[model samples]
Target: MQTVKPALPRPVVAVICDRISYFQHNVHAVPETYLRALHEAAGVMPVLIPACPELLDLSTLLATVDGVLLPGSPSNVAAERYKAEPLPKETLMDLHRDETVFSLLPSVTAQGIPLMAICRGFQEVNVFYGGTLHRAVHERADAIDHREGDHARAIEEWYEDSHLVSVTPGGLLATLSGTQAVRVNSLHHQGVDRLGKGLRIEAFALDGLIEAFTAPDAPGLVLGLQWHPEMSLGHSPLAQQLFTTFGDSCRRRQQSRLCTKSTGGNDEFISAYAV
Candidate 1:
């Protein structure tokens, strides 16, 4: 008999789309950096999950992908989702994304799919798990000013590492980054106010705001960051480490899927549907 080799399944990651308006036309968009990271750094196929309510079917989609990437966006998570009234000047909300991401989380947690949630995605994870957020971190009594000096400055200056985040020693975040402290850019005015269910702090900023978090109780890998690793990868070794760790998790999930499919074995963590 001729020798044969087994084929490995390609890992597929779902990257959520964003709702946008351009020239009076509605658009569903995904950032090029995020797509590039998933393809170039992570070496996985990224499927853009549409933000439209009418289109998203959470269970089916979650069952098909090895991981999920919740990328940052210009629109902010609406305050109303966490039972808070919106501020007068709150960034225009993307209710489409808000609802879609919330619906997707329960499935991701239950299915053991690795998740890399960044920036606004971090806040969404907080809210999805029953936590609340402060409207503006800079305005809070204890929170320091976490924004660049002027909005008119060049984009490079805006994304520069403006502050340091102290990682929890021996925690998941520290294990992933291999560092106790890391300097990260400050771009957000809002931050976590109350922690959500099953979520734990992984790192905190100098201003005492939560900068990164993970869900310990969840079956799969979950890493949430307040800063943008997608923007910092070139100069930040920690950024490269974070993405590499996440990519490994996704590959593991893909292998698990292949195993179950071949053997018809029961794996609650990798199961597509609940019994």
Candidate 2:
């Protein structure tokens, strides 16, 4: 009898990159913060997906990965995505990234790929799902100042926990964090102004700003957080929980894919594995 070795492979996560001009040369980049957190905290391999508009088959690209992560960036989603007026010329923008991520959102949800978006990526998710954003969250009388502004403090201070967000009851966030409220870092100027379609409020700041949301209709986890959890992955229990949960989801997805391949697409055999 021939021996069949176990088919086990580490889960690989597709992390979207931002297009930027580094040293006067155009480049694709994602912050090291996200890479470190995904590898150390999430326990998964992180692969960068370039923000190239030439890639026409996003679904095909997504098929190779177990999960997708949209990391925070200095750029903001173009106002036109939400039918809002454009920001001043001074605002940082990455049109290539905007187009690539926006295109991938639908397939990620529909294909049952676990997704986690942070900060600017959170805003992108909202805009993609017919939600609008308050371009200046602090200027709103009813909202708190969520901006980590021009203080002469250290970079770490910019990502420090600034406020508490009330978690929605019975939501995935509450279950994951095991608490109704969690303190989070605030560094963005924009926030979700109108709730997106198919998304449930996961958490919000005291001032009623939408801090986090999840697509309940998604086959797998589709979560977005308006904070830099990656910045405190070592110290914050909530951050650790979030990444661990995401990592586990990716591993399960990887297992299921391997099972399908090993079973020659036999549903019964795949189900028996219960991956």
In candidate 2, stretches whose alpha carbon ends up further than 4 angstroms from where it belongs are 1-7, 262-275
Where in model 1 is the C-alpha error above 4 Å? 1-9, 263-275
**Error in Å for residue 35 of model 2:** 0.6
Residue 27 in candidate 2, Cα distance off native in Å: 0.6
* Model 1: per-residue Cα lDDT over 1-275, one tens digit each: 97344444458999999988889988889988898888777878888888986887666786689999998876788888899987567376888999888888888888889999998899999998899998878998877787656878888888899889999987887887787899998888778999888888999998789999999889998889999888888999888888888888998888777556634454533343312
Candidate number achieving the greatest TM-score relative to the actual structure: 2
The per-model lDDT (C-alpha) reads 0.84, 0.88
lDDT of 2 by residue, 94-131 (tens): 99998988888888888888899999989998888899
TM-score, one value per model: 0.89, 0.91
